[model samples]
Target: MALAGALLTGALAGCGDGPVRMGAAAVVGDDRISTAKLDQAVLDCQRQFKNDQVANQVRAALESQRQQQPMSGEPADCSPRSALDTMVNFEVAEAAAKTAGVSVTEGQVDQMIGLMGRQAPAESIVVALGMPKEYTRDVARMNAAQSLILQKLGADGNQQSPASLQARQQALSLFRQAAGKLDIRINPRFGSFDENRMTVSPVTTRLSATESGVR
Candidate 1:
């Protein structure tokens, strides 16, 4: 139900538009995602992984009994840049959901997390995907909003009726408009972002990057 580990990230080289912001990992519209904030998030994720190793195993075992697919394996690098990419994607998805008139309330996030808890402790799954423990609710809200928006557009279902196709197009147009209005900017220290694909890949660089707990 959650991103199912399908994070759109890689170490692949790509180009991002807009100017780099000082001390900011990214700038989405008026808000800034600070580099320090991103680093702290990555640290939190790594710490959660280490602290919840047993919980992670418990989650796997529960999911197996339920016959649910396991969460996607962690990305090879779990790169700090990739961790930032998750935040960016969540931001974009939230904006798009708002624009589409799809709302995911606190109660909805609670329900989603409740469902996830049945698979394993929500914190364990969240950290397994390299997200900060503090973001567990925020992540649940975004994923819930994502599914709601897609279901509304009939994009998540198998039906390909003309009406469904039209709805899909409408969803795409809405997301594109939302993204364009945001005018996202990324720091070269992280990587380039492809708006069309909603994917972030590292750019060519000579600068050194320090990844706490990843070394």
Candidate 2:
């Protein structure tokens, strides 16, 4: 998800100008990420979010504020569409790594997860981001793959360094190029891909403030 640059240079670089496979949330290369898979992931994430003490406290505070005065809009929360996006990103990143001949071992993934757990509870981070626990491995794989790609491109992992930033941009360009070749497709019900952002653009619906309060 950190990669930047156009994901597709043109329609020609996208999933073919043909109908997408039925019941598929997305297609990455030859693999289908079924709608069922996305639904299950979303359900898992929602359950974890509901059980997380921090998330519950935040929601309770939001509700308290809403009762005191008319809230402007609904509070932010994870959605199934967001889960679909996350899965798509994982698939794309994995495919890009494969294309680049980058490898990430299970041990590397576990190590990355351990490092993340130092900042905060890793499970809480995954749930807050609407990612299923099972996808944690994929998340670590993506991170490891990206880090390796950056190093291969001569980028030091220092965000504040101008040279590092430039090198990262160059690596991102390569990632995008590899992603473009995969012919990724997303179901229109979820949203379309934003070639410029190299990510899904979920469709937005604007509801009246009163209608929003009902939810």
Candidate 3:
């Protein structure tokens, strides 16, 4: 399914044909999310479950339904919204990494991928992220970059890097600090991703299997 969406993206670009086509901009404060970007997020999910035709069928359907629904009335953002938030978060992390003199080189990302082994970083990243290895290497790079940023921010004394509760807190603190004064407004479709008040709905009740229109 991910492969199909990827192949269809260029064909759908401005025509607004496929499920991956960019829809409308979900403007939040100064930030504006184009439908194309949102579509890409949806594709990411499809790519994750590419191994299971049944899962792909269900996910694609649910995505199609979501595309038609007006985001204005929905109060919760689901996983796709979470994906969007991650994008927003990545921007902040990139900026923070710059300030902290923390940079993730292609070599480093490659090293991380090597640690994960064979198929490629994109594939390894799916395992690392517990996500599907879809889209392209660029997506994998972004994921690796985000992971690097989190590791750097979350690192403690450096003796033995432990992904502990404190590390998560530190990473969040860095993220918030780096995000600084950016104003983000979530569309009603995507519920608030407040660290203190996160709300996730079961995918089954909110989405349908054939709604997204993916193969």
Model 1 ranges with Cα > 4 A deviation: 1-18, 54-78, 155-173, 205-215
lDDT of 1 by residue, 50-109 (tens): 678755675455456555533433242235876887888788888999887889989999
Task: Estimate, for each residue in 1-215, the C-alpha lDDT of model 3 and write its tens digit.
Answer: 76455433332111112222134333333556675676666666555555544444444544566678855223222256555654555455566566656777778767666655454344533422323345334444555665665566664545355655566666666656555444444443444335322222212222224534543
Q: Which has the better TM-score: candidate 2, or candidate 3?
A: 2
Clash pairs for candidate 2: none
Q: What residue runs in model 3 are displaced by over 4 Å at the alpha carbon? A: 1-31, 52-78, 117-121, 124-169, 195-215
Task: Encode model 2's per-residue lDDT on 168-194: one tens digit a residue.
Answer: 787777767765777777776676665
**How do the predictions measure up, each by TM-score?**
0.71, 0.75, 0.49
List the global CA lDDT of all models.
Answer: 0.70, 0.68, 0.47
Instruction: Tell me the deviation in Å of residue 165 in model 2.
Output: 0.7
**lDDT, residue 162, model 2:** 79
TM-score for predicted model 3 compared with the true structure: 0.49
Q: Which consecutive 10 residues in model 3 have the weakest lDDT in total? A: 12-21
Better of 1 and 3 by lDDT: 1
